[model samples]
Target: MKASEIRELKDEEIVHEVRRLRRELYTLRSQAVTEKLENPRQFGVIRKDIARLLTEQTARRNQAKTAGAAE
Candidate 1:
């Protein structure tokens, strides 16, 4: 998923997407270990997507914290 698309998602939606991606990643890893994956590059793509979602979430959390602290 594109970072721009992810960033446009609501916070709750982003959390749900992260959970879904992690589950998919686990399934992909198991498939890779037991058999040949159709697309091994998917692993890297999922990982980066997860990272981007997490990064955006963290940034939002930190921004909230800083805003609260400033109040």
Candidate 2:
């Protein structure tokens, strides 16, 4: 998924997506070990998507913290 698409998801939805992606990544890894992976590039794509979601999650948390501190 694109960063903009990821940014549009709610925090909970983002978390869900991350979990789903992790599972997919795990499956891909297992397939790779068996040399059954059809697309080796998928690993990088999923990893990037997971990172993007986590980054967004962290940014939201930091924004919340700063906002609370400003009050």
Candidate 3:
């Protein structure tokens, strides 16, 4: 998923999306080990997307914390 698409999601949706991506990564790894994965590159893409989502979430949280502290 693109970062723009991820940004469009609400916080709750992003949380769910992260969980779903992790599950997909797990499943892809299992398939790869079994020599059944049709597209192993999907694993790399999913991992990157998860990282992007987590980074965005963390930045948002930190921003909120800083704003709260300044109030």
Candidate 4:
């Protein structure tokens, strides 16, 4: 998913996406170990996506903290 698309999601939705991605990553890794994975690059892609989601979540939290402090 694009960053813009991720940014449009609510915090709860973003968390859900994170969980879903983690599960997918686990499955992909298992497939790779079993020699059933056709494309190893999928693991890298999923890892990056998870990182992006995490970064966005952290940014949101920091923004909220700053906003609260300002208030």
TM-score winner between candidates 3 and 4: 4
How does candidate 3 fare on TM-score? 0.92
Cα deviation of 21, candidate 1, in Å: 0.4
Query: Per-residue alpha-carbon lDDT of model 4 for 1-71, expressed as tens digits?
Result: 88998899999998999999999999988887887778888888888888989999999999999999999
Pairwise TM-score winner, candidates 2 and 4:
2
lDDT of 2 at 14: 98
Ten residues in sequence with the least summed lDDT for candidate 2: 31-40
Worst 10 residues of 4 by lDDT: 29-38
lDDT (tens digit, per residue) of candidate 2 on 6-64: 88999999999999999999999898898777888999999999999999999999999
Alpha-carbon runs more than 4 Å astray in model 1: none
Best by lDDT: 1
For each of the candidates, the C-alpha root-mean-square deviation to the true structure, in angstroms, is 0.8, 0.8, 0.9, 0.8
**lDDT per residue (tens digit) for residues 39-65 in model 1:** 999999999999999999999999999
Instruction: Tell me the spans in candidate 2 whose CA falls farther than 4 Å from its real position.
Output: none
lDDT tens readout by residue for model 3, 1-71: 88889888889998999999999999888888887778778988999999999988998899999999999
- In model 1, residue pairs whose N, Cα or C atoms come closer than 3 Å (at least 3 residues apart or on different chains), thus clashing, are none
Error of 2 at 36 (Å): 2.0
lDDT order of candidates, top first: 1, 2, 4, 3
TM-score of each: 0.94, 0.94, 0.92, 0.93
